[model samples]
Target: MVSPQVTNLAIILVMMQVSKQVPFDNPDVLLGVRALYILSNLIILGIYLYIQGKINKKRDMTTLKYVEPAPVGSGEEPRPVTTTVMEYDKQQLRQLIKTQMMGVGMMGVMHLYFKYTNPLLIQSIIPLKSALEGNLVKIHLFGKPAVGDLQRPFKAPQGLFGMGQGAVKSDKASVENAEKNWRGGVKEE
Candidate 1:
């Protein structure tokens, strides 16, 4: 016999896959599809949280490679600045990953859940369509990197995740703030 969690997980997964196959002409069908998508996120998040706790009891290693820094300085020539990092132990890494995973996944679940439940949330949130035409709104949506600026213009449904993450940011604010502060916030910035 499957535990309630496991059964629910299965249902969520099946619905998620089925939602992909469904046509989206009818509003009811579209709503169902949206619901399944939300359900999939919740299940994924639930499983992530479940595994996160278990992972906490074991070793979880994270290897951070030096990524290119945001371009800094002015004038024609620019230089790169790299930060020093150390190798974290497996257990410590796992704990960190677990903590981060649960934080991000849970917040993501909540964000999508709210949108799915409340139609007015997006409508009320997004300013006038004309407002989006301004550089300010576009910059908010696309973003301008201060140092190594490289954010791209968001494209429709593909950009939804970024939009959702932005909402998450407004609730919490800074990336550093999110990392050290929030009970459930992603370390990915």
Candidate 2:
């Protein structure tokens, strides 16, 4: 449930500490590893885009509309309103794909730079980046359930040894509610 910014910051701090402790001077190994990472990311990105294309094709062939309840005044009765929603228009889909491609490109650049400067830093960030990309692909292309536990802001750990029971309980409840409403829950007027 850690925020991405916080997680990134922690990764950088750990990388700095580890780099100081274990200095790596082998450029050949770093380059090899960086190349492998970039190749793997590109492969995954290609697959994600392919799947998204298929999904968008299917969506574009369909016309979807739904009825939503209109807001009612204190003394009025609720009325249902029909709304037409283009879930995956061609332009929007293209834009989404472009954005994801840009993200992958940026990740590749950052990772390669970090690998050369501080080899240890790239290790921590790679898994985080992969998980984020996987989540993005899942939600957009595969229609898979998201990890609802991360929707809320993280509470500072509080207790003896920083293992707080109150925070755990609240976090658990919030996660449950989030899971229940994961797929754009029903709107109440």
What are the TM-scores, per candidate, against the unseen true structure? 0.25, 0.42
* Candidate 1 lDDT by residue in tens digits, 29-139: 656645654554455445444444443443323322222212334322111112211222223335434654565465456546653333222222122222333232233
Which 10 consecutive positions of candidate 1 have the poorest summed lDDT? 149-158
Please report, as a residue range, the 10-residue window in candidate 2 with the lowest summed lDDT: 77-86
Off-target runs (Cα >4 Å) in candidate 2 are 19-24, 60-116, 119-136, 140-142, 145-189
For residues 1-189, what per-residue lDDT tens digits would candidate 2 score against the true structure? Answer: 654556666777777787675434677856665565566556655765666666555553433222222233344222222222224333334654576567656665765565444543454355436445443445555565534632212232344345433332233444444344435555345
Q: Model 2 clash tally? A: 0
Give per-model CA RMSD.
Answer: 18.2, 11.7
Candidate lDDT (C-alpha), each = 0.36, 0.47
Q: Candidate 1, after superposition: displacement of residue 74 in Å?
A: 11
The best candidate by lDDT is 2
lDDT score at residue 107, model 1, on the 0-100 scale: 46
Q: What is the lDDT of candidate 1?
A: 0.36
